[model samples]
Target chain A: MKVKFLCIIALSAILFACNTPVTESEKNGSEQSRKSESEDSTHVPLATEKKVELKREGIFMFYVGAFEAKKMDTKKNPMLENKINIALDSISGDVIYGHSVVAGNIRPFQGTFNLKDGMYTVVAKEPGDNKYDGVFTFTLSPDNGTLNGVWTSNDKKLAVSERSYDLKKTEFKYDPSLELDGTYSEVYNSYNAKTEQHEQITDDAGKLNASQVELTSKDVENMYRRDLEIMRNAIYARHGYSFKNREMRYFFDTQVAWYIPVSTDVTAELTDLEKKNIELIKRYEKHAESYYDVYGR
Target chain B: MMLGLSTLKNKRKYSLLVLLSVYTYFLWLMIRITLQYFPAHDDVAFLSIKQDYVGMWHYKLAFFIHVFSAIFVLLAGYTQFSESLRKKNPKMHRRLGWFYVIVTLFFAGPSGLIIGIYANGGTSSQIAFCLLAFLWMLFTLMAVIQAMRRQMSSHRAWMIRSFALALSAITLRAWKYILVALFHPKPMDVYQIVAWLGWTLNLVVAEIIIIKKIRS
Candidate 1:
C-alpha cells in the first residue's frame, strides 16, 4: 500500500507537470503556436512582454535561418547554415557593411537594426536593384546583450521561408593581423618587439605586472578573435566538418544537448552558412594541404 | 531556522540556519530575476521565448517547471527536517513529504532532464545536468521505497541524498560567483565546471550528515 501510495504521488507530479490549463482546443493550436505565424516553419519564438537592452558594440554573430531562392541573374543560396558575422561599431552601434564569401562567392549586403521596447527587427538586403531581403526577429538576453530569434526571407524574388537563430556577443576585435598560416596567432610578436626596443619602459612596467606581460593594442582584438574562432570552429564541427578527427563532434557533449542529421552521408546539400564555413576551412586546408598531400585525404 | 529554536543537535541547528539563510537569499535572487523579465538583461536564459523559434515553447515549459516547482520543493522540503514538525505535526510531515515527492519526480526531474538536453554548454554540461536530474529522481524514489518498507532510517538517508541533488540550483549560482571572482574564465567554462561540482558538493555534505547520524 505504501509503495502504491508513493508511486501514485510520483505519477501525480508527472501528470501535474504535463498538466497545463490549456484546453483541448488550445492543444490543437499548440501545433500552430509552435510553428509561429512568422516562420511557418517547425519552431517559433515564444512571445513575451519582456524587453532587453543592447548597446555594446563588437562582433555580434547571427544564425541565418531561411531564404527564398530566386533563380535570378545572381545565384540565390537558400539556407544559410553557419553564422553571419556582424561587425557592429562600438561608438556608432551600427553594423559595418562588408562582403563575406557567401553562397558561391563574396556577396555584398546591407542591413538596418533597431533596439526598442525589447523587440529586435534586423533587415538584411543583398545589395542590388532587386535585392533578397531577410527580416530577423530577436529577443535580448536578460544577462547579456545576446539576441536569439528566427528570421525569414521577405524578398519578392525568393521563397518566403524562415529558420531559427542563435546570436550572442563575443569578445570581438575590429581587426586581427593574421599570419596567413592556417593558424591565426596573436600579433603580439610586434608588440613584444616594440617593448624590447623600449627596454626601460618595459622594465618599469615589469615591476608592477609580476608576470611580465606584454601589453598590446591587439589585446582585446586578439582575445575576441580567439573566442570567435573557437565558436566558428565549433559551428563548423556541428555542420559535419571533421577537424583533425572527431574531437569537435563531442566538444559540447557536457554542456549542451545536440541532436542532428544522424546520417554519415557527407553528400548532403550544404546551407549558405556551411558554404561560408567551407570557405573558412579552405584556409586551414590550404595550409594543411601540403601536409595532407604528403599523407592522405 | 525559526531563529529561536532549541532542542536540536548543534550541527543540525547550525546547518539549518545556514540553509535557511542561503535559501532566503536564493529565493530573493530568483524572484528578482523573474520580475525583471520585462526588460530582459543581456544574459541568462530567462526569456528565451521572445526571439527563439519553433520548438522554444518546450524549453519555456521545461524552464517553468524547473523554476516554479523549485519554490515548493525548497519550502516543503525545509519543513521535513524540522524535529518539532515531525513529532508534533506528523501529519504535516507526511503531507509535505508527498508534495516534495510529487513536485520533484514529476515536475523538477523530468523538466530538468528535458531542458538539460538543450544545455547551452554543449556536451559536458548536458551530461552533468541530465545525470543530476536522473540521480535526483532515483534518490527520491529510493526514499519513497524505503519509507514504504518502513525502514525509517533508510528512508531518511535517501531523502538526504535527494535533497542534496535539489540543492544543486543553489550551489550552481554560488559556485559561479566564486569561480568568476577567482579566475575571470569564460562563462561556459565556469558553467561546465560548476555544473559538475554543484550537486556533487551537496551530495558530499549529505553523506557527512548521514555518517554523523550513524556514528552518533
Candidate 2:
C-alpha cells in the first residue's frame, strides 16, 4: 500500500509538470477566437446630407503672449522659450493671420476666425516661441456671442479671457454664467442687461472667484515655462511629438473661415476690427519687458 | 479490574480521535470563510485565473461540487472512528461514509483536477495544492473500494490519509495566520515557504496516525 501511494504521487507530479500538446492547442484556439470577436465591433459615425443653419454672431479677438521657465530652481527661472497667442475674433467675417515685431525680440503673432454658434476647438500649434502647442475647446453660442474660457498648464490655471478684453487683466471679474454647472443658461438669460452694461455685476461671486482673480505677468510666465518643460519631458520620453510650425499654422488658418463667415455683410468691417485688436496686442507686448521686470522670472 | 481498565483506555482513545476530528472540521470551516473573504494575495497570475475561471459558469459548477463534497467528507471523517456512534447508529454511519466517498469521486476529484491546472504562485504552489487534492481523491477512492472488499483495517488507514489531505485546507490557513502574527507583515517569499511547510507537516501528522492504527 505504501509503495503504491508513493508511485501514484510520483506519476501525478509528472503529469502536472508536463504540458501536453492537446491543452496548448486548446488555449491558443480560445485566445484567437476572442481576438477576432473584439476586432469585429468598431464604431462608425452616421453620414447626413442636411445643411445646418448658423446665426449671425460677433467675437472680440485679441492675442496674449508670454514666456515660461524650465526647472524648479528658485535662483533663476531658466529662459525657456514658451510663447502663446490668444486671439478673440469677434464676428469677424475674414480670418487674418499676423505677426508683431516687439522690443527685446518678443514677437507675438495670431490667427483669427469667427466660427458658427456651436462647439469649436482652437489649436495653437508650435506658436513660434513656445516649445509646446496648446489646444483649447469652447462653445460659441448665439446668445452669448463670445468666447469665455480659462487656460491651464501643468494642472495650474494659467489665465482667463473674455470677448472684449485686448489685454487680460490680472484682476478681471467673471460673469457667473461661465461656471461649469448646467445653471449657466439661466444666469445668462436672467441678468438685467441695463445694470450689467453700467456695472460689471456677476450673479455668483464665490463660484466666479477663480475667473475674477488676476495673475501677475510673472505668474503667467512661470506657468508658460512649466507647460513647456512638461512638453519637453513628454517628447523626450517618447510619449508624443511636438507640433511642427507649419501644422500649427495650417490648423489655425483652416478653422478661421469656418468661424468668420467670409460671404456675409460683416466681412470687410470685421477684418479692420481684427487688425486693430492685433495692434493693441502689440502695444501690450511693448510694455511686456517692464511687465517681465516686475513679474517675469 | 483489568477488563475495566482496557475499556477505559479504548474509551479515551475513541474520545480523543472524535474530539480531534471535530476540532479539525471547525478549523476547516474557519479557513474556508477566511479564504472566501480575505484571500492571501492579489498577484496578477492569481487575478487572471480567477477572472477567467472562478467567475465563469464551468468553474462555478466545479466549485459547488468540491465544496458540497468537502462538507460530506468532513462529517464522515469526523464520525468514522467514533466507537459510541458506530455502536448506536451503525447504519447512519455507513450511509454517511458511502455518500462521502461517492460524492468525492464524482465531484470533488474532477473539479479539483480542472482547477489544479490554473493554481497560482507558480509551479511549486501548483504542485503542492494539486498533489494534495489528487492524493485526497485517490485515498478516498481506495478506502471506499477496500471497505467494499471487507478490508476494514486497510479502509480505515486510507480514510485517515484522505482526511489528512482535507485537513490541509485548514492547516494551510492556520499556519498562514500564525506566521502572519509572528512575523508581523511578512513578504511573499516568507509566506510561500510557510505554505510548503504547513501542508507537509499536516500530511506527516496524518501519516503518523495511520502508522499507529495499522501497528495496533
Candidate 3:
C-alpha cells in the first residue's frame, strides 16, 4: 500500500512534468494585434515621426563581448561573449518599438531611429524592470548590413557595465536538416561537480539527427549523458529557442554558429517528429549513467 | 589447549563479524538501487532502453520477479554460509539454505533467464546473461542434490559456486563503476564487457576458495 502511494506521487510528478499547455498560436496573434490597435491613437506626435520611418524591421542578432573595467583583473574577468537578438516588432515613423531576446529573458525596448548622412543610427532603451537592463546605441551600415555599437548597463556598479556588439541581420527559419556539427564536439559548459571534470562528447552524437529521424533504443542505448543532452537540445537550437538552462545557453551560444536567440518558449514550433524524438531522448537521458569517478549502479 | 582453541575461534568469529558488516553495507546499497525501480515506471534506470521488452507482459512479469527475488536470495545466501550458524543451529541453516535454493530455482533463475534473452548491449550481453542464469540454476540444483545424498563436502563446494554467481549482481555493478571511471567507455560497450566479467571473475574466485578448502 505504501509502495502504491509512492507510485501515485511519482506518476503524478511525471505527468506534471510532461504536461505542456498547447498554446493556440492563432489566438495569441489576434490578442496581440488587438492590444496594439487599442493603444494606436495616443494623440502624441513627434517632429520627425511622419518624415523618417525606419523601413528595416526584423530580428537583428548582435554578438556582444563584455569585459571588466581596466583596473579590474582581466584574467579574472575575461571577455564574456553572448548573443542577443533585437526584434523590431513595430516601427512607426521615428519611433521603433521592439523587444530584446538574450539569455532566455525578453525585455521590451523602445527608441528613436535617425538617418543622418546615409548612416542609420538608433538608440534603444530596455524597460528598467531588471537590474541588468541597459540601453543599446547602435548604427546600421547600409553597405555591410551590420548593426554595431555599445550597450551601457543602467547599473554602473556592475563589473561589466559596458559591452560592445557587432550584429548582422539574420532571419530565423526552422530547417529540419540542421544537425550538430564538429564545433559541438567539445563541451565548454556542464561541469561535473563530483568528478571536477567536463565532458568531451564523442562523434557518435553527431551521427544521428534527432530532428530528421525517429530514434530507436538501439540507436541511443549506448550514448553518454552529454551526448544525449546535445542531441536533444540540437532540435531546440535549430528552432531559435533561447535556452533557460545556463549550460545549454553556454553550449549553444558559443558552439552553434547558426543558433539565433528568438523566443524562450518554442514548444509550438516543434515538429511532430522532433516532439517524438525529444520524448525518446529524454527517456534515455533520465536513464543515462554518466561517469564521474563516483559510485553508481 | 582449550584456551588456545577458544582464542582462535574468537578470532575467526571476529573476522566473520567484520565480513558480515561489510556485506550488510553493500546489501543496503543494493537495496537502495532496487528501490529506484519500485512503483515500477517503464523508463526507470535499466528499463530505459528495454522499452521493447518492457511492453511485453511476460517480460515485465519476469523482470519484477527476478528483481524482487534476487534481494532475498542475496540476504539468505549469506546466512547459509555462516560457519557459526551452520555449526550451532544446523536446523536453521538447513531451512535458510533450502529457502535460497528454492527461490533461486523456482523464481529468480527462471525470471533471470527470461529477461536475459532481451538484455541490452545486444547479442554479447544477452548470451552472457543467459549463460549466467543457466549456470546459477545448475549449481544451485547440484548443491541440493549433493545435500540430499549426504555429500557434505561437494554440497558446500556447489553452494559456493552458486552463491558466487548470485554475487554477480553486486560485482557487475562494481565492475561497471570501476571500468567507466577509469576508461570512460560507452554505456553499451561497458555493459557488454561487464556482463561477462561480472560472473566469470566471481566463478574464478569461487574455484580458488573451493580448491583451497579441499587442500586444507
Candidate 4:
C-alpha cells in the first residue's frame, strides 16, 4: 500500500510540472492573439493542446469627439467629447462582453455584430439598472477602423434623449514623457457650498514630468491642489487608466487630447518611477490647503 | 472731574469688552482647526504630508507639544495685557504672565523650531518659521526679564512684540484666505509668501503702535 501511494505522488508531481508549461503557453497565445489583432495576421496558436483560433478579443478604444444632441435643448448639453473602450472578450458568436467608460462611469454592455455589404452593423445595450443606460446602434467600417453610432436613453425624460457619436479608432501606448500643456480655469466641485469662483492654474503646473523625473518638494511645493491632482492623474492617463474620480474624468475627458480611457486598472503597467511619483504627489495632494475651502493652513 | 474719570473708565471697559469678543471669536476658529487632530491619527490635517516625519517619535512629540501648548499662551494674552486685570488682581496677572512666558520659552517655541525646520514650502518658508520661533522665544524671555527687573514699560513693549508673533498663527491662515481669493497662486507659493507676511505685517502694525502710541 505504501509503495502504491509513493508511486501515485511521483506521478502527480510529474503531471504538475507538465501542467505549468501549458498555462504559460496559454498566456503567450493570448498575447499573440492581441498582436495578431493589430497586425491583421492569422492568430498563431502557441500549443497544439489548444485548438481555438483567437478572434477579436482585446480592448479597442475609440475617440468620440462630440456626442451631438439630435434636438436642441437649453437645459442640458450632451455635446462633450470623450473616449470609450470596448473590450471584445468574444466575437465569434452573437454574444459579446464589453464595457464603455464615459465621464468616469464604467457600464458593462452586451451586444451583437454582423457583417453585410462590407459594413458591420452592431447593436449593444447597457444594463437597465442605471437610468443613463442606453442602446448603442452603430456601424463599423470593413477594416473596423471607424465606428459611427447613435445612443438613445432608456429614460425618455432625460434632457437630451438622443445623441450621435462619430468615433475614430485610437491606439493606446504607454509613454512616460507625455506632459499636460496649457492653462485651464474651472470651478472646482467640492462639498463646500460657498466656493463658486473658478480657480486658475498656471502653465508652470504642467512643466514637471512626474513619470520620468523624481519630483522633489521644491518642484511640487508651489503647485495648487488642482494642479497636483492633474499631475498625478496624468501619470495614470499615460497608461490608459480609466479614472473613477469625477474631477479627473472631467479634466481628462474634456481637456486632455492624448487621453484614452482604456482600462479601469493599470497597476501592473506602472513603472517604479511612476509609482514613486504617485506616492509623492499623493502626499502633497493630501496636505494641499487649496483643495478645500481656505480653513486649515 | 468725577464725571470725566467715570466716563474714561467706562470707555476702557467698553473697549476691553470689544477686544474680548473679537479674541473669543478667533479663539473659536483656532479651536475648530485644532479639533482636527483630537484622536491623534498619524496622517491628518497638517501632518498628512509630513509622513516623512510622522514616523519619528521626537517630531510627533514636538508637533503635539507646539499645537496643544500654543493655545494656552494665546489665552494668557487676554489677562496679561489687561490693565484692569493687572491692577485689580496683580497675583492672577503675574501667574498668567508666567504661564505664557514659560510655555512659549520651553514648549511652544522649541517645538515650533523643530517643525519649522521641516516646514513644507521649502527652505524659504522653513527659514521664515524658524526665525519666527526664535524671535517668539527671545521676546517672551525679554518680557519676563524686564518684569523681574521692574522695568514695566519695557516689559509691556516686549510682551506686545511676543503677542504679535503669537497671533501669527491666526494671521497666517487669514492671509492664506485673502491671497487665495485675490490671486489663485499655487498653494505653496501662497504658503511661502504668507510665512513671512503673516508675522511681518503684524509686527509692522505693532511697531507703529509702539512708536506712535506706546512710546508717546
Clashes of each: 45, 16, 0, 0
Tens digit of per-residue lDDT, candidate 2, span A1-297? 423433354344334433322111111111110011212112211122211112122223223333233333343322233223333322223432222211112222233444554634342221423322233333333343343333322322223211121222111121212222212112112245654532111222122112223322222221221121221111111111111232221221222111111110112222332333223222223222222122110
The CAPRI category of model 4 is incorrect
TM-score of predicted model 2? Answer: 0.38
Number of the top-ranking candidate, with TM-score as the measure: 3
DockQ values, each candidate:
0.02, 0.01, 0.23, 0.14
Candidate 2, residue B28: Cα displacement in angstroms equals 7.3
Error of 4 at B4 (Å): 7.0
* lDDT string, candidate 4, A1-29, tens digits: 42343335434533443343321111111
Number of the top lDDT candidate:
3
Model 4: residue A84 alpha-carbon error in angstroms: 2.9
Query: Per-residue CA lDDT of candidate 2, range B1-216, in tens?
Result: 999999999998687656664565454444334233223322121222244455666665665556545555554545666656667777976897878777777777777666665554446666766777788789998998998899988888888788777666566656656664454332233335544775688778888988887787
Alpha-carbon TM-score of each model against the true structure? 0.42, 0.38, 0.82, 0.76
At residue A267, candidate 1 shows an lDDT of 26
Error of 3 at A154 (Å): 0.4
So what's the TM-score on candidate 4?
0.76
C-alpha lDDT of candidate 1 relative to the true structure: 0.48
**Model 1 ranges with Cα > 4 A deviation:** A1-297, B1-19, B34-54
